[model samples]
Target: MLIHGVALMALAVAALLAAFSSIQKAGWLAAASVAPVLAVAGVLAAWAAAIHLTGGEKFDDHPWV
Candidate 1:
């Protein structure tokens, strides 16, 4: 989960940069295309972090434990 979260966050950051560049260069269509990816990845990353952090204690049995 942690790894997944990290990966997703990285993707979100990249998408955000791309979206910004698209907007700055007057490429609204490209920006619009990447918007959903940005939103979904950003939200899922947050959710993964929250689940991992709150799922159990330090000694609990889990994949990342």
Candidate 2:
């Protein structure tokens, strides 16, 4: 999940840069499409980190066992 979050953020940044650099409709569309995806990924990443850090719950009983 962390990896995904980082990847999505990178994609969003790239798309944003492209959108700003290009005045084409497709560039704007690509940026628009990725905006929400990035937002959701960011939220999930933060939520997961919060839960993990707070010791909310664990999916595995003994991860190494």
Q: For model 2, name the residue pairs that clash.
A: none
| Cα RMSDs, all models | 6.6, 7.3
TM-scores for all candidates: the values are 0.46, 0.43
State which candidate has the highest lDDT: 1
lDDT for 51 (candidate 1): 59
Residue 41 C-alpha lDDT in model 2: 59
- Using TM-score, give the best candidate's number: 1
The whole-model C-alpha lDDT of candidate 2 against the native structure comes to 0.56
User: What is candidate 1's lDDT per residue for 1-65, written digit by digit as tens?
Assistant: 56765665576567666556656675667567666666666566656556565642365478876
